[model samples]
Target: MTAPRFLQIHWLASYPGTLINRDDSGLAKRLPFGDAVRTRISSQCLKRHWRTVEDDWALNQIGPEMAVRSREVPEYRVLPALEAEGVATDEIRKAVVLALAQALYGDKAEDVSKRQALLLGEPEIRYLISKVSEIAAAAADAKSAGEAVKTAFKEEKANLSSMRKNGVLEAGLESALFGRMVTSDRAANTDAAIHVAHALTVHAEQGESDYFTVVDDLARDAGESGAGGIFDTELTAGLFYGYVVVDLALLKSNLGGDGALAGKVCEHLVHLIATVSPGAKKGGTAPYAFAEALVVEAGSRQPRTLANAFRQPTAARSEAAAAALAAHLSSVDEAYGAHEKRHHLSLQPIEVPNSSRIGLDGLGKFASAMASA
Candidate 1:
């Protein structure tokens, strides 16, 4: 039988004496969930780490490098290409600012809105440059050339949906999986296939202010008692709970109905989610760690989080958290009936109801096969 329509993954990872995520105040991010304030990591931070990693399971390795998100595409890419083609400077800028701007960015004549960093696929970029060059080469003068570009862009805008459907520009792998929002055009927008929750510690945040001094070697040798520099940083240690839900159908649809690629992504993504840690102060804290406990479930039932498992704020120990999760799952199963298939992997080998005990490799492959099925 084919796998269910959704996959939900829950994990517990520990980062001791490390600030996995920090707020604008440079303090560890926090969430007041269930009676305690837990140290938290934002979904944006987690996805950025996974999307940009160059390791064996890197998302970019599966396809193209990345979509270019920039406000300098005209100045850097288009203008340079046009210059090499001997297009006049005035024509190029006018097309970029007056014509191409309306087509790609907005109809506004102002420059500030066009300055926003917009995500453009490489294929789309190449097509734009080629069209702009052709328009400039054909026109009798600069003014006509600018008008031609605007006309060409209008045609391009009308074909956005078909181009995306036909895989002319999937907007890179990142956009296909995580999604992209085009404020001006709904046709250009791709809905997110993977939904991630902000990860937070189950217990109260274990935080500390670490103060240290960097002494000058010469000053110390010269018998000076004062330190060269003094600084302090916040550090926290706790077992964090992370949850992610993958819409299998949406993933395939976003990838242009490529089911095999979708399966591969789910597999690699499972590994990435379990093994990858948010890299913050790695040199000092060495915060790298694997999930201490993982529970992956597949079902069509409306997805739910087990966050309430720790409503009383369990201890930070892996065993304690794992036990609490197991008990909660058992209670949930008894109350609602077990309808989904589940797989569990834990450092302590705790019981997770309706789940098969599996190793990391086996779990990834199983999830992949299920997604493909």
Candidate 2:
């Protein structure tokens, strides 16, 4: 039997890095599946651009300015509540700090009716904006990321379903099948990818062998220490998880073929993810290593082209400009698809033992402690 066609995905920006101060509109940048610099859209970027948090402790009040005058607001109320409960003043203050953070970043929904009216005054833009907001709001409401995606699909079933059925169609407003063009802001996208590219290049320039092992070690360190605050590792991990789900949702809705196409999609995703990491070396053996391996297993020597430029941004739809890229993405997609064997090196799930203090100790006591707790 053929291996299951689940998407093997990793967030392109899940690895940690210091956020460089730049006067750029895009959040992050990285190299594309091919050799081109493309904007990196991380889970952090998506969440920051959208997502709302619900703060249970914060007082749901009037406007912020009006909230300042109220003694019941978090800045005042939480502290007294803790103090009265005999909590230390310093501890109360720190808890309050966390509370404020929750107020801003937690998954609470705000009444956007008034603001929506003001910003999206035009009916057409308002409709699209409303749909987009609905997608974000529903995703935020669900407890798990998967639930959030389910919520999003439930809300926008018709549109997303259509996109899945038809690969990607661009036409006039009335004739257009998929109205939401993700790449409309081509310049912005390129700029974003460039930032990710610069960071990756800097890492590559340092010169290293054992690229995968070295990067994985760094990723592990960053994750354990929470040094990946800029990248927001956990959330990014969840977001990439959602992206795969979204892809599958599309495939299912489209009612696409389930044979070799399934295997190909899985292979492409795995290879794409391996190379998308922060420190994937650009030269020598690593260049098309994963793709080459996949092609060899599939027993095809197809000459694939990719949209790769020498570390710079380009116009998306420019006929002459996009030709190289369009060719590349096509071949890359196909070459990955042709692989026959199960791509074992794709993704290995890391099991986290359930214990107060994790690792080997957590392994044996996990069940017992959970039962007792």
Instruction: Please name the candidate that would achieve the greatest TM-score relative to the true structure.
Output: 1
Candidate 1 structure, TM-score to reference? 0.89
lDDT of 2 by residue, 345-372 (tens): 1122221111022222222122122111
Candidate number with greatest lDDT: 1
Stretches > 4 Å off in candidate 1 = 80-103, 106-116, 139-148, 154-156, 217-225
Give the TM-scores of the predictions, in the order they appear. Answer: 0.89, 0.21
Model 1 residue 57 lDDT? 86
Q: Against the hidden true structure, what lDDT does model 1 obtain?
A: 0.81
Model 1: how large is the Cα RMSD against the reference? 2.8
- Total clashing pairs for each candidate: 0, 19
